[model samples]
Target: MAISLAALRQMILAHPKALAQGLSLLVLAAAYSPVSVLNLSPVYGSAATKLFHRYGMAVTAILGWFLKERIHEMSRGRIARLLPVLAVSIAAIQFLLFKLSSWLGSPFGPVITESFTYYPLLALSIAASAKLIQYATEISRYGETIAEHGPLIASYVVFNLAERISEAFISKVIGSTFLLTRYGLQLVIAALYAITIPSKSLVLTIPLLLLSYTSNVHVPTKHTTAVLNERIQPYGFELIDRRDSLTGYISVLDNLNEGYRVMRADHSLLGGEWTKLPGQYNPKVKDPIYAVFTMLEAVRLVETEPPRPADQDSKALVIGLGIGTTPGSLISHGIDTTIVEIDPVVYYFANKYFHLPHNHTAVIQDAEKFVKKSLASPTSPRYDYIVHDVFTGGAEPINLFTIEFLQQLSDLLKDNGVIAINFAGDLSLYPAGLVVRTIKHVFPSCRIFREDAAMENHPAVDFTNMVVFCTKAAGTPIRFRNPVPADFLGSKARETYLMPKHEIDASAFETIEKGGQRLLKAASVDHIAAFQDRSAIGHWKIMRTVLPDAVWENW
Candidate 1:
């Protein structure tokens, strides 16, 4: 430890500017890793997500100032003499790094994730690494050669680069608000590796490294879809399809023996449909294999809420389009459905893989943004049924769940309208309690039902999915018509479970100490987030049970 510190001190003193540049690379890696995926208290998560740009830029500037002298010294060089020489040297080093990295990480040249923007950084990093090494060599004691330290330098660059690159690919890069932040984090690291060091050990380490990485390598190809399927084969499943979008990682997975085709968004399963197609397994009904998906369809069953319009005459709005189960059902039944989904990839995947209806209007935008616009327009159309099925990545959209957003949803509804809000969380947690209280406040006469009525026997299973059915009328009864086989579209599964009376009723649980039972306005939603962290972790474990661990890890 003492030798390490002394060596670090000597290296910093000798080539502080190079270390500063490398620090930027380290920061880029950290920001893009699982470190950014933390589930914080509602208030902290909101502040951190929204203000990341301001803080990230500030950090970059601070790193620059710390390494300012090396930049200043580089500027002092003889440009006329060094210009061509440095450019040639940088190009040569970059070509070498690309071959080595591509062989180890990508099959082609460096995996050009975004055109050639990041490729140039490879040249820049190599040049910087070379200059930094030259500076260190010049400062060393007269008898020692820089080659003596080549092994150590290679270890540093390769280890850090490998960690950052793997994580940036495996973990979602969601720290920055701007699209620019999504650009090559690995490119910066590659750049620093180019600029700071180009040692023989980097080239020599590939043989042992090649084995662990073979099946999971990602490089864009015309056969990119084929590559994803090949990658998941080792995990005992086939990746039927996958997409990287602004919101999160979305995948459609199928295992014939498991008898289901599941849609996954990061760690959470959006929903699943039974694999029994018309001929192969040949089941009598088109029933969903997952009960939670059917629970979302129950809003259509609210009988006492309104009387006038038929399914064709009434309109329905869906907030989050998870595999389009509810909206597709609405559209099929001849309801004029409009879906507001934030992620375009999700909308696309739902249409392609989950059989989402294309006949209705699709608004590929955030629910918050869409709601704000709808509220602004004087002639905005009202919805007879609004489905608030926005659960994703183990949590509901925080902004949309706020009392303010819920009230706007109320405004968008017709006077006799009914709403179904699907939320997943521990029944014992403040988030679940607060959400229930808030819905009751917004809709007056609402009843909550658990997705699995059978789950009531297990007190250990606190984290579960529930749908709240609410009506606009305060004093009116919010009841469901007994679903006949026709109402279920001939699916016995839906007829049996869609409108089950099993409630995760607020009255059943003990009162939370010190008002965890309190209603959450937009301002108080932060407190709910603080409590929701454990629930999210619980969700992560629950999701693992739904699929194998290897599948989630590879994804």
Candidate 2:
């Protein structure tokens, strides 16, 4: 019963057309698979759990349509009828997997949730390939009808690709243009589909479209004057400009009657001190809980005397510049300060509204990239002080909190240099503990202090900010030198902020549990990803008090 090699070769040569048709279908299935995955990205955040179900149904429907055309024996009605059942089955399987992943305490929970879309697309691709194989078998028995429908098949393939491309384009254009008026666009989409589709199909689609529309409608109207007056406006500021960045909100505010102004990022209360206040000034606050802005003043205090001719010009490197507060302060004290700010909006707002010191150089780049480049070149002068104050949404940048990043800061600093890092978070959380441990691992000497000790000690009552001071040399006590009274008030806005009432105690750091583990310095991408989701949730809750939920929701 064994077939000879010569006979197999002859048969294969005789049915080259069928083989080619089957190969083409397989290629189309593969192409569609990746496109289906790409389609999931936009829906990931909004749909989250339901994304898989929706994409699975869409893929199944598409595959069913394709199969009905290819398999002449199957009626379109029969194939279409099976789509809902298959889609449900796929969704059930994905849901179970998602639940299992969550129960296992795996970091894969989000990935599994996202995979709902991917798995269904994969199933559809397999189904399409199976249908193509069946068609090839039928064509061989029926003397090959595929050749006759070649043009139609090609046109269908082109149409499917065009449809996907058009759908994506329309989705983006509509979503962006009608962002505030999404309900109207949803109605339009529903109406168009209703007019073109059969009654039964329209009935199913309209509800789905409505749900999708409702899920995505993000209007900016859920705001109150109480939020503006109590939380934001009472700071003696009026919001002149605001923009969303990859990091967070960057806003600029001006004093109504006075020439004073301030710039801020969401949850980043005060970045650096006022450099260009209207008149001469003295800081009334001594022993201030060093925020990102005031921490830069440490550079000015590092030197007991003016710079000698032999000494290199005192340079301060600031990793995250919110409103250019620290850099401005450093520049005022005659230090050559270089600020590296990743967000252009923050930089723009600082210069425009905050009246940032005009003398310093601004490098608009990622701190990691800048550090790496500076490290490779030995010619670059080491900084006298490095202020690492890039906090937003009540969480420190996990990447910046790593030991590798801290070591880079150490490399950039002079022998007597000091580095102050501003970290804002709940000390009880694993994120804060991990960050402090990481910093301690990198720098030999470190001191942790809260912005307000009274607030921090009351664990039941959550606090917003904390700063960690670290230096290369061992046993260097954290101190703020030469306290000056507020001489020239920049603005009423500045006056309200500059008054030092919040006192930080070193004793608060004693309560921070290290969890009986030695400090670890290196953190991989996985380490960061593991903590991000929980940290983001914690940050979201903290930020609600800083700004109204409506403001964050609107963004």
Predicted model with the maximum TM-score: 1
Which one is best on lDDT? 1
278-339, model 2: which lDDT tens digit per residue? 34543432212234345334434433222322213678898887766556656665678889
Q: Model 1, which residues run further than 4 Å from truth?
A: 1-188, 196-201, 205-213, 217-236, 278-285, 454-458, 515-517
Query: Which tens-of-lDDT digit does each residue in 116-162 have in candidate 1?
Result: 32223323333344444446534344324444355236534653575
Candidates' C-alpha lDDT: 0.59, 0.49
Model 1, residue 134: C-alpha shift (Å): 18
Off by over 4 Å in 2: 1-292, 295-299, 302-312, 392-394, 454-463, 485-517, 521-525, 528-530
TM accuracy, model 1: 0.68
Our tally of clashes for model 1 stands at 11
Residue 412's lDDT in candidate 1? 96
Whole-model lDDT, candidate 2? 0.49
TM-score of candidate 2 to 2 decimals: 0.55
